[model samples]
Target: MLALGLNQFRKEHFWLYHVKPTDPTTYAAVGVILLSIALLPCYLPARRATNVDPMTVPRHE
Candidate 1:
């Protein structure tokens, strides 16, 4: 659907040709980068949490 929408054009259009297919190497690199980015927030908090002692946190009575 996305490909179709991108490829579909009006009479006066900036793009007339179909977009080039992504290279496997490029795709793999992008996938790895995206995975790392997506996991960053979770990773940092988990790492920080592991390093901290929960007992040190102040408890509200």
Candidate 2:
């Protein structure tokens, strides 16, 4: 619904094509941003799991 409205708004206002596609440097920057976002969750979870309370959970089955 909102997408349709926005498309109509862009057509009426001629705003959609105002910005050009990013350059190579911008692509590199976006790639770095995406890579960092992908890795952050894995790193944070691994670090948190390493600090788990030793007393609360058995080390062996």
Candidate 3:
């Protein structure tokens, strides 16, 4: 992703984001957004998995 971003954008870009430059807030926000996007979907399945009774899971013969 770092390499992809670097290749996608030019250095010293006028926008808030630039390939060569590093911004803590930018990275933090990006991390949070991506994490939310990713983890939100799995929350339901994760919760359900935790609630499942192992003994009730049917065993294949």
Candidate 4:
């Protein structure tokens, strides 16, 4: 919805040179890239935490 609104605003006031603001392929690619960027850091820490022994965690605390 935001993209659509932005595209509308752009269409009314600005000229996009050879760009398609409402392209589905561009949207999907950007969505996937953003999702991967967001999830990678979270996944790495969770994966590392899972590898640690449960018995050792309380000893440190």
lDDT of 3: 0.69
TM-score of 3: 0.53
lDDT per residue for candidate 3 within 1-61, as digits (tens), equals: 5744684466546355442355566667878999999998999889989987777778632
Clash counts for all predictions:
0, 0, 0, 0
TM per candidate: 0.51, 0.47, 0.53, 0.77
How well is each residue in 1-61 modelled by candidate 4, as lDDT tens digits? 7878778766744335655777777789989999999999999999999999999999999
Report the candidate with higher lDDT, 1 versus 2.
2
Ranking by TM-score: 4, 3, 1, 2
User: Can you write out model 1's per-residue Cα lDDT over 1-61, one digit (the tens) per residue?
Assistant: 4533553454235334642343355557867999999999999989988986677765632
Best by lDDT: 4
Ten residues in sequence with the least summed lDDT for candidate 2: 14-23
lDDT of 4: 0.82
Q: Could you give candidate 2's per-residue lDDT for residues 1-61 as a string of tens digits?
A: 3544455545645434563242355557877999999999999989998898877678553
Worst 10 residues of 3 by lDDT: 12-21
Clashes of 4: 0
lDDT-wise, the better of 3 and 4 is 4
